[model samples]
Target: MELHILIKGERDISGQIYTQIYEAIESGRLVQDQQIPPSRLLAKQLGVARKSVADAYNRLTYDKKIVGYVGRGTFVSGAAAAPTLPHIEAGKAVMGSLKKWGEHADMTPLETAYRCAVDFAGGEPSAHHFYQDEWRSCVLHGLRQCTAKRGKYGETAGVKQLREALIRHAAFSRGVIATPEQMVITNGAQQALDLIGRIVIEPGTCVAMEEPGYPGARLLFTSLGARVVGVRVDSEGIDVDAIPEQAKLIYVTPAHQFPLGMPMSEARRQALLEKANRIGAIIIEDDYDSEFRYSGQVTNSLQSMDKFGVVVFVGTMSKVMFPEMRIGYLIAPPAIAKAAVMVKRLTDWHSNTMVQYALAKFIADGNLLRHVRRVQTIYAQRREKIQAVFGTALAQWFELLPTNAGFHMVALAKRDINIGELIARARADNIGLYSLRDFYYEAAPPAGLFLGYGSVDANAIEPALIEVRNILRAMLWQQKT
Candidate 1:
């Protein structure tokens, strides 16, 4: 293939290639889905290392400017030419030509809608947790230690030091009694879910999941060919009575349910554990956002109460620390941990070692605990600020639920109002909130909006509420017309 490399000044070899490709796409020189040369081939042509080309491809992928299908190779994303819809879809629709693979599929219009001048999207912690000085200190120390020797892949399970650190943290903070050998580090809880799904969920197996639950879990179970049955959730948490005994796996966010922000009551947790053991089914407990409880003494983790070893505890730093950290782990039974190690080794060959080392030191030095405490204070204040704003702006048409803990809350829009249309209006004003209707499997359960407050600050809350009120008010006018 003839190299169409466009060198632009002295911005480094990789930068030149990246800019040329981007410009080519914008200028119509590269058509949609056009195949690109292999990274190795491109690197050889440009007289640079393949790593440089890989880095360029990674940047493009993050920007959604290119598509890289595993095994099939990289191409100009066909989504570049896809037509836009005025409103988001009520259900999943084909958005582009990309073969839907993983959890990004099945997201509805309301699930994805909401744009914001200041985004308060769910499942994110504040950037303050990624303290540059703290990260740099840890990175420098890790580099100094690695200077003597690059740590070889220690165990298929994970690095021992990190596992030991996590075991202590879980015992003290989460009430889960786990040993280092019982834990396996993952690329965040998403991958933990994927690994467990791979090992336990055979094609077409029945899995019980809470209704109005985490879509990420729902998508993973569905993609793995699990027959996902939605068990309705109530004030306390997932209705233990509603879940079927035949389910092979029961997934729950008992620490704090996603989107809904309700914690599983102790009674419900005990019932679920008893029921799960009776049926000999595996319980996957996703302890998401458990670190930021603002209420009374934090609830004990479901895994802590389990004597049957049926609960597979999934823990991640994504909510408490930063998502880029990509360090989550699963505390599995001795039987499952070995199988999980084999599956994980085949998947990604363990997580990034440098980050793992840094995380180990971070926890050992007690900085992670301190950081979480600092962040919890900030999130609690922001949660209150958002509640006050919601009260003033949405009082007449909405009832805000009390989320004493966690970074998000739920608001039930008036029964007469269309939740989807209201969200679209909010998007027009540049606010990307989410709707609770998208959280359920049924046609309708409860009509409400899921508001994430941690990502935004006190300064941005009132103005955001103004925009939200305006959007809802305009939505009413449109309905009247």
Candidate 2:
């Protein structure tokens, strides 16, 4: 490869060449095992004597930075691996801030060292549910209808068609009552939270989040400079008594808790609302993927029960559709509805125009609900298989938590077991597993497995879980030994 070397003056041309090449190696411009140009070629390019180029090559060889084989020519044999230059004082401060941001980054569906054949990672939706043919038609319809005004940016509050459709969908399905004007479509539920945080949170604003909650929401608020307080979650969901009265914003997954799957008891929900009203706090109710409940009293969204107009309801299609379809919406409490819409406008100036329209049509034409119903049956079956296996094959080891809804469920280990080691061993046997370790903002997270069956097929469920049981048994036996 041609190395860029400038031969300025004829004096000490070889020295200049050697120094430049050395610097190149040091800077990683020339990496290890990279071939350099022949001395003769370099000499001709540099308009210098071949001997001068050869002398430089000889010096590099002597330093063991490069070596030449008879036919292979010169290659970078040895060089001090990539050298780190001293950071500037200004850069140090920026890097320190970056490190702080890194600490608050989202941790979910963790990347395992090995690719597991049967992955039980949370946040994945089943492809069996994806309305490929129906969605294709909807998208084509959207492209035709939505692009009529192709030059215009979509409304920050989402397209009119979507807002209207979502209003109907939410009311019928989740019992959420909202006007089209209050709906602010976002990139995803994640963005909706960010927008809410932007309007309500200032530096050191007191925000309460469910401990062992969705790490994504916790980190998002943390990044926004909110003083996030972790409230303990038990069988009834976030312990309302545990939340500080001063917490300005309270984020809760009331329908189904994240990582640890437990719906908030109605009494607890009422108590939480009273607390919020007493303290004048806004509640962010993330009703993510509550559509696939197997068996339980059909719980209406917190928005339906909101009398004080204090709850900002968030919903996403990612769990119902594929996760890559980054679309979600938020129904702001009447007081902050305009403010949330304004913040959304400033944040990204609205989401994908065509996508919003396509989703609107998908919902309006009943494709979305039909898709959900079909998949709901399949998912229920998968959930049943996992429950049966854990009940029969895995009962001795795991106590299945009380959960009746969502793509995943929680099962606490029967005794003190190394949850981390259990995960590693399961992964080794080609089953990706997760515990509720990373979600905790507090030090002590409960010992349990968050078994998600969304992507796993019904027939594959028993075999995969059987293998998991086998591995767990071996681990337990080894421990006894």
Question: lDDT tens string, model 2, 219-308?
Answer: 788889999999988888898988998999999999998877888888888888889999989999999989888888988688888898
lDDT of 2: 0.86
Q: Each model's TM-score, in the order given?
A: 0.78, 0.81
Q: Per-residue lDDT tens digits of candidate 1, residues 363-404?
A: 898988988899888888888777787678778888887666
Q: Which candidate gets the maximum lDDT versus the true structure? A: 2
Q: What range of 10 consecutive residues in model 2 has the weakest lDDT sum? A: 106-115
Model 1 residue runs over 4 Å out of place are 1-115, 477-481
| Positional deviation of residue 19's Cα in model 2 after best superposition, in angstroms | 21
**Residue 296, candidate 1: how far off, in angstroms?**
2.3
Superposed by TM-score, candidate 1 places the C-alpha of residue 471 at a distance from the truth, in angstroms, of 3.1
lDDT against the true structure, per candidate, is 0.81, 0.86
Give the Cα error of residue 246 in candidate 2, in Å: 0.7
lDDT of 1 at 323: 85
* Model 1 lowest lDDT segment of ten: 95-104
